[model samples]
Target: MNMMSMSKLSLLSVLLIAHCSTAASDLPKDVFILAGQSNMAGRGGVSSGKWSGDVPPECKPDPSILRLNAKLSWEVAHEPLHSDIDVGKTCGVGPGMAFANEVRLRANESKIGVVGLVPCAVGGTKISDWEKGTRLYSELLRRAHVSVSGGGVIRAILWYQGESDTVKKEDAQAYQGKMKKFIMDLRSDLNNPSLLFVQVAIASGEGRFVDSVRKAQLGINLPFVKCVDAKGLRLKDDHLHLTTMSEVHLGIKLAHAFLTTLK
Candidate 1:
C-alpha cells in the first residue's frame, strides 16, 4: 500500500527469481546407459533392504529405473529395461539405483543428473547379434545417439552380457573383435572417444559357458572399458540370475570402476 512497502516487495521478488534461475542452471544432464541380457532385465524379486526407504511416493518400480532429479525436479532415467515381461504383470529391480547413489556420493555438489537408459539388449543375444545395420543393433545405436545429442552426456555404459556366445568356443574368441567393433562404433557415433564402459563378468551357473563367456568379455579391452566380477555374489533361485542384493553389489562395483576411470 505504501511506497516503501511496494519497493521492498519488488526487490524480494527479483531476488527470488534470480535464485531460482541459478539453481536450475546448476543441475546436470548426465546419462548412464545399461545394456545386456536377462540379468540386466532383473529376474530377481524386489528386496526389502533395497526397495525399502525414503523412495519418493511418485516413484514406481519397473524394468527401468526412473527417478526425480533432486536439483532440477525433472524425471531423469536411471537403470535399463524395455518391457516388464511378456505376461505383463511383474517387474523387478536392478542395480541401477545403487549405481546412481554411488555417483551422487562421489560427485557431490556436481551439476549432473542421470538420464534415460537406452536398453537395446535382447535376452538371448550374442555379440554378433549387435552388428551394425542389423535391426536390433541399429535401433540401439539410434536411441543412444539421440540421448547423447539431446543435452545429456554419456557418462558410462553398463554391459552384462556374453552368456549366449560361450557355448561355441569359436564364437567366444570372436567376441572380443565383435565387442571391440561395437564399442568403436558407439564411441564414433557419440563423438566421445573417452566414453566409459563397465562390463559385468558372467557368474557361475549351471551353464558350461560361464567361464568361457566371461573370458571373452574381458578380452575386449578398450581404454575406457572395465570389467566387474559377479562371481561369488548371491544369485537368484534360478542360479543364473543375480539376486537384488547381488545386483546392488554389482552396481556399486561398476560405479567404483567409473569413479576410478574418472580419476
Candidate 2:
C-alpha cells in the first residue's frame, strides 16, 4: 500500500480504539431487574383495610437511580417502581426503590456511572405466568434486553412472587420446580451464568398455602440464588400486603443479600 494509505489506516484504527474505550467507560454496569407480584411492586402506605398513609421518607424518589418508565424509557426512579407493569390497581411502593437506593449507596454512584432498575412486577400474578414462554416472561426478557441495550450490564434480578400461587395447593406444591426452571431459563436467556437471583420468601396473610410457597421459595437450592425471609414482617391492614416500614426492611434485606452474594 502507499505510505499515505498506510498512515490513514493507522489513524483510523487509533480513532476507533479511542471511541470504543470512551463508550465502554461511559456505559453503566449495575442494571438490576426487580420483578415479581404486588409485594415486589410495593403497596406501602396504601391502606386497604381501614387506615390510610403516605409514602415514608426512606422510600422516596432518588435522582441517582434510573427506572424504566411506562413509555419504556429511563427516568428518575420513584415509588411504584413497577408503575408501567402494574395495570390492576394503582402502583405503590414496593422494595424496589429502597433496594436501588441501597445499591447506589454501596456502589458509590460517583465512581460508577449509575444504577438502572428495570421494574417488571405485576400485582396478583402467579408463578405459572412467569415461566419461560408466557407473555410476562417474554416481556421481562424483552425489557431486560432493552434496559441493558443502552450499554449497561444486568447485575441481578430481584424476584418476589408466589402469593397467587399459594391460593391453590397444586400451584404451591409445584412452585419449587417452576421457580427453579424460571431461574435457569432467565439466566440462560440473559446469558449471564453467574447472575444473582434474589427471591424474597412470601409474607403472611397472602393465602392458605403460604407455607407451601415459602417452602418452595426456600427450596430453590441453586448456586448464585439467595432467599430472604419475609415471613414475620409487619403487614398492611389488608393482611395481604406489607406495610411501608416492613417494605423498607425487606428492601434492606434484599440489598444486603444482593451486595454480599454478588461477586
Best by TM-score: 2
lDDT of 1 by residue, 169-192 (tens): 678768778888888887887788
lDDT string, candidate 2, 85-150, tens digits:
787766677888788777777776234357888889988889999999899999999989988886
For candidate 1, what is the lDDT?
0.64
Q: Can you give the TM-score per candidate against the true fold?
A: 0.72, 0.85
Runs of candidate 1 with Cα error greater than 4 angstroms are 1-28, 46-91, 109-111, 114-116
Q: What's the CA error at residue 233 for candidate 2, in Å?
A: 0.8
For candidate 2, the lDDT comes to 0.82
Off by over 4 Å in 2: 1-28, 48-53, 108-113
lDDT of 2 at 65: 78
Worst 10 residues of 1 by lDDT: 49-58
